[model samples]
Target: MSTTIAPDRPARTGEAVPRATAGAVLGALMRQRLRRDRWQILIWLLCIALLAMFSASAIDQTYGDANARAQLIRLAIADPTIIVLRGLPQGTSLAAVAFFEIYTFLALLAGLMNTFLAVRHSRAEEESGRAELVGSTPAGRLLPTTATVLHAVAVNAALAVVTALGFIAAGLPAYGSFVAGAATAGAGFAFFAVGLLLAQLMNTSRGANGFAAAVVVLAYLVRGIGDAMGTPFGDGTHQRSAWPTWLSPIGWGEQFAPYTGDDWRPLLLQLGLAVLLIAAVFGLQAVRDSGAGLIPERAGRATARPALGGVFGLAWRLQWPTVLGWTIGGALGGLLAGALGTVINSSIADNPALSGIRDAIGRIGGGGSGPLTQLFISAIFSIIGVLAAACAVQTVIRLRQEEASGTAELVMSAPVTRTRWLFSYVAVGVIAVLAVLLAGAIASGLSAVAAGEGASTFGDSFAAAAAQVPVALVYLGVLTLVFVLVPSWTAPVGWAALGLGAFVGIFGGLVKLPEGVRHLSPFADAPVVVGDVDWTGGYWMLGITVVALAGAAALIRRRDFAIG
Candidate 1:
């Protein structure tokens, strides 16, 4: 009964490979990514350069005058929100303040690009199955990750160079320009590492992306909180209390203090953190199996629940995660708004300069102070709702992707009709959008109540939050139509619509763009409730939304499933 060992079975070595060979393998992978993504690399570099230059030039035009610079400084000193949002410059020069004010936003964009690029090439490709094919060859396990990190570094370096040049061209001091550029690059690298870490932890690329984005948002919030709570350095209040700002990654970047102290230590701290994160990522990868995550994928229901039999149920299933994500984000945004409102109200009572700016904002929003504040909060929430709608639309398009990928076939083979299947996802998306809006409204209402505003004020705020629904629904409809009629390009088209709407609705006024262009955004037609609430626009938006949705349903019904 003794068993003989199989001749084909090789003895286990129980030893790891040489470090030098591992290094070479990683280097090769990095080279592969660089070579493959050169086009995207170039595009990112170009975009960053252009954006930095444009921002610098715009700032120069906006605050070049001494009077304007003085006025801005005065206002910022009085308003904590402005300082927190824009940051503080050391000098009166347009370039100095511009770099200070815009660097955070620019860094955010750069970080986003880096994170997306890193994950898109690494985890995203892995999830999509392309990585398996690549890995089956002579490629090392760590090669792709190494390559992605390298790519991120190269791109960020390019961004830094471009930003530095832009600042120099804008007449900023050379040292300050260097600090600003490096700070931006450093921030990007930090987030790139974060994305890598997330990619390793999440089972899906989408989950990784969402998690990474949530981290970025948290970093921003932390920085904002720190900035809002921080005392002026020279104001003799407490010198030891700079701890909050010191803890934030964004704050660390800001601590480079660009035209001011030009502190280089914070940049070193950021770089150190990035290196640690990358090292952690590698360590985690070493312990985990390829294509597996640190967190195990949870087992979903094998048998569909009775409630999942219909269109509505399917819709809920598909859209719930996205709806929840947006709801959380909106609530956080509302909280931020509430905090800012508190700051603004206090600032208005104390500083004439802030009061003037507040009055100006009020006029733009259409008059009364209270109404103006409500309108401002509403506008912000509306934007959040629109983002939620975009998420919903993407969720719908996910169904199309599933169909294309043949996953839908499995579901369709079950006791589900095409109409029910499609409607289920559509209904979920719509409900998710509404949920996000409601969450935002509730958050704002709570904030208003906390701020000692009247119950009517809470009602007004919630109403404004609700008002965004129709506009968001219109976008959802457009996406649904696209998802039904032309599934291939639905994502790009849907995202583009959201981007265009945001640009036209939010920035158009600031840029003094034409009314017709502004009106193209669904939000443009939304009534301003600064002084008074107008129900007419709400009715119109509702009607338009209904029409668009109906049109989408009709189109979806008429079209055959292209994948099937």
Candidate 2:
């Protein structure tokens, strides 16, 4: 009893031990992430490839003839909006010019994917406590960061390869095809590096994501402004200026010009900047503690107020920031649309080629004239509103999150009925959605009025924008039903539902998809104002909302709370 057992000791070395190389660490991390999330990654990549191929084939068929190409070029030069939205490349080849027009948007989407993935791997893991376990092993400090970068590199590589193959298969020149693909991948990599730097600086995942997204929005704005200024309409002829485009990363990528000038120097600058960003990440890692960031997290309130006693109040408090953000964002988007609409109406009168572009927008907007164009713009704005409503639904499901974390049990034990608690959050979501839609309507209306449009014009635009709310509510109801029935899988299901709706709403008309599939999107039934207001679709949308909400409520009543 007096004798003490000797404790087992870790192995000690007299000489310095060689750690794993950065590349080895990076490779292992990339493989692990790929193995864990292969399905999601594969699906995302496949979607991108399919869309690119579809776009390439469509352009080939649409503008294959010499006369068609000439018409398109002439029309593009005449409309400032067309040129800003889709750049005019100096190429006679239909495929090359099409690549130039679409590459900017594609590259932006690719960048978003890379940035989000990188942040999820590097920062989100640490926030969730998974990184601590990984770090406790023989892993070096730089290993996780290296792995994130390597994974991003692999994704970019795959994107580039797939895009290049799609273009080549679509019968484009090999050199130009490869150049376009590489430019997109290069831009994505640059943003991936930028995201890492943001992740290192911010404590919360939301903050990091918001910062990165803001940067992307800024890049797009810079490109738009530059393009607009460079080709201002004076005497019905197009002129190009270089200064504005020089300041934008997107513009830098575009300067490669796909098939036109085929410039390759700009890509080297992108790569160099990425390298500098990586070095900065390493320096940040050396200075900061594990599981923490350069920016300190604010100290939350030590005590909860009586108003925070219920689920609805708590939901509002948690979701208010995101709701405000989307509301502000949607309002700004509406204002921009109004401004653009005025420009289009004014500019189209003087230009003949520009006339065809309006016809195209009208067709997509369900084929009407003046008022219908405004309705089409309103529909686009409504999509943004739908997204905001989806965010609200997700916030309401944070109730489940709270329950799983053991906080809900304590609150429930303090004498609260489940129905009242659930409805509270639902009520808050309803209010938030209405507030956001109203904000958007007001902003768009003000913009229209400022542009010398009639007050009645504002009323019509506001009505069209608000009409999509019922469709959005139906989506929210469906998501809520999923949460009640299968809580564990609700997040993915909800996100997939939103993604499917977006695909159908945006691309169904563009591609020759089946009518049944397109009809499944709630947005497909949304009212579009061609010449006059269409109230028929509004009734159908309202009916769908009622059915979805009733189904969700019924499901919730039947199901027991799935919590510990």
Determine the backbone clash count of candidate 2: 1
TM-score of each: 0.78, 0.82
Q: How much does candidate 1 score in TM-score?
A: 0.78
* Candidate RMSDs in order: 6.4, 5.3
Q: Which tens-of-lDDT digit does each residue in 1-564 have in candidate 1?
A: 994332243212222435675576677677777776676556556555555565566567666677776666665555555555555444556666676556766666666666766677767777767777655543445666666777788878887888888778766777888888898898888988888888989887767877786777677666766766766544321121146766667778887777767788987888898899999988887777667888898898879898777656766665577678878877766775554565566556675555556643442232234643564575466556656766676676677766765667778788877666776776777777777777777777787778866666567656666667777777776677677777765644665466446544654443234567667777666665655566576678777766766776677667666662
> Number of backbone collisions per candidate, in order?
4, 1
lDDT of each: 0.66, 0.66
Task: Give me the runs in candidate 1 sitting further than 4 Å from their true place.
Answer: 1-54, 88-90, 162-179, 233-241, 260-264, 299-302, 335-343, 363-372, 379-383, 386-390, 393-406, 412-426, 474-526, 532-564
Question: lDDT per residue, candidate 2, 1-564, as tens digits?
Answer: 594332243112121214543345456677898875565566556655655565666667666786666666666565555455555345556765567456766666666666767677777777766777566443456676777777778888998888777777777778887888888788888888888999899986667766786676577667766765665343333335457776656777877777666789989877888899999998888778777989988898899988787667776776677677767867876776666666667677666546776765553443346753484465446455555656555555565555544566666776776666666666766776776777777777788788877777577657756766776676666666667777755544554455556555544443334557667776666666556657676688667666766676767667666762
Top-scoring candidate (TM-score) = 2
